[model samples]
Target: KQAMDFYDRALKLASTIPELQFPLMTYLGKGNALVRVGRVDEAKRVLDEALAVAEGDSAYGYEAELLLQLGLIADQQKDTARALALLARATNLAQKAGGNRIVAEIALETGRIQRQASRPSEAESTLRAGIDVARHMAERLLLPRLLGDLADLQVSNSRYAEARALLEEASDLLEGLLTNASSPWVRSRIIDSMDGIFLARVRLEGAQGQNASRLFAVLEQARGRAMSELVSARDSSNPAELRAGERKIAALQLKLLRTTDRSARQRLLDEIFRAEEELAPAATESFIRTRASRRKPVTLPELQRQLRADEVFLEFALAEPHSYALIATNHSARIHRLAGRADIRKTITA
Candidate 1:
């Protein structure tokens, strides 16, 4: 709660700071602050006013974007119907405006909200539409992120082979772009884009833990107490809950990256561990219904052959309330549970 309080204060500060420099960015900050405080109608009115002034080919396009933002605000407020309705309107406007990029953006946003609402089939269709648009436009940057999002949805829906293909495509695209990027900013943006790709791979690893290869297998261990309970409650858990927990963990991890305060970082780490704890690693209904993907793990000799003499391979995985280390060498590989993430964090920050 203290960490959240600090986050709140930071948000308030950011909303007021005039040093943001860019006029559009400042306006967006104010608009977002209004939405956060339940002044949705007021925010909508402001967008409506802006739409009143926009002209020509850009008018409907801008209007579509504003509607998309409102749809996102509705989703945040848990008004799924309102959100989807707004997105539909935005999509129609974007299509009429004839901009493939805006069309793709609305599709992606709508799909994400749909996934959150647990309409997986609809979400998949919407995401696939966006992917098609992205491919048509030759949108190298946007396509990878869309692929990652759909990969995540596929994992949740227990389409492991589909998920694996999408993740591999995204990973390959991202790595290819990293080699092609000409500037530091471009490289950094590409790196930021890999977060979801890595996350989807992690989910795939966890879901296929029983038999899959460790290509992206960081690790998976449940909270000790929850293990027995998890098996008993296995059929009760849903894809929505798993996706929600992963989103929470991702948000906290992002916060951890931005924070410098020792105490606040620890709190965020603790929250991450606790959030992960609730997500015990038992298959959902989709997983139970679908056959898992199969792949061969890299042998110890193969892994060692790829590594330099000075480089030792170590993979850290957040196994719910606790953490673990998978250490590999030329001759062998082993995994052992370490202390909780908070303890490791404290030790590092000390």
Candidate 2:
């Protein structure tokens, strides 16, 4: 999982690359990567930046791809209405741009959202249609996830045999993909990408009273190949500080696209260079050093020693439909479930 900052060059983001080439895909791919790592808001903003670039270039193809990504994000957020609206627009743009591959991608996502909303028949039709298009277009990547999603629908309807066959076919395709992808980084991405297949299989096995641990081992086999490449950054990095710097870089990059004044553009270029130079180490490194950092883990007893008698340490996990907190004092610790995602969002919004 890459960050939004991974794809930026210091200043060479001149004009726009061909929609087929990268710096365009850079923005699009990085946005998708960020979403995979659960950085939802960051993904949205980066995609917005990508859209800005596409609009500047009048590259409607890139716009279609970017809109598809944004729609996927909206789907994750469970804003079905917004997701559908964006998908409809993306489908139109894709057709105009001759982006059949994107249309197939759109169908897969639209189907999943429909499934979530309990429109089973529509979802199945949409997914099956996507699979056909994907096959015709050689979109091997989309086919497995499409299969997995359709399998999920089948499972919901208690069509166990159909679901099992679909999952097995999806798994076989994924295995072939993994076998062909030789690069460690590429293999890691492939493993992450096919998570849906394993998930669907898990559901099928669970529904049929098969051993879930056996399914986990199979899934683990897939993930084990990429374990080294997938190590997360240490907890010491200050996300807020990093986000500020990256946002500045993004703002300057967008400004670089719009400004016609030569010297003003040069100044912006120089600033972006400096900011990128400063941000590079932290952004790329496995561990980043920060001000007054705690680089080493502390045991609970040791952590307790650092607290004042009147004070307690509280760690909260804010999740959808509910939240949780771990409260620890010098003597004791306890976990408490608090609010739903909506309630928490409302409070945060307020």
Estimated TM-score for each candidate: 0.57, 0.51
Give the per-residue lDDT of model 2 (tens digit) for 176-245: 8765664446655666657767656655655554443343344345445335233432343456657788
For candidate 1, the 10 contiguous residues with the lowest summed lDDT are: 217-226
Runs of candidate 2 with Cα error greater than 4 angstroms are: 1-58, 210-350
Deviation from native of the Cα of residue 271 in model 1, angstroms: 50
Tell me the deviation in Å of residue 329 in model 2: 44
Error of 2 at 235 (Å): 28
**Cα displacement (Å) at residue 112, model 2:** 2.2
Model 1, CA-based lDDT: 0.70
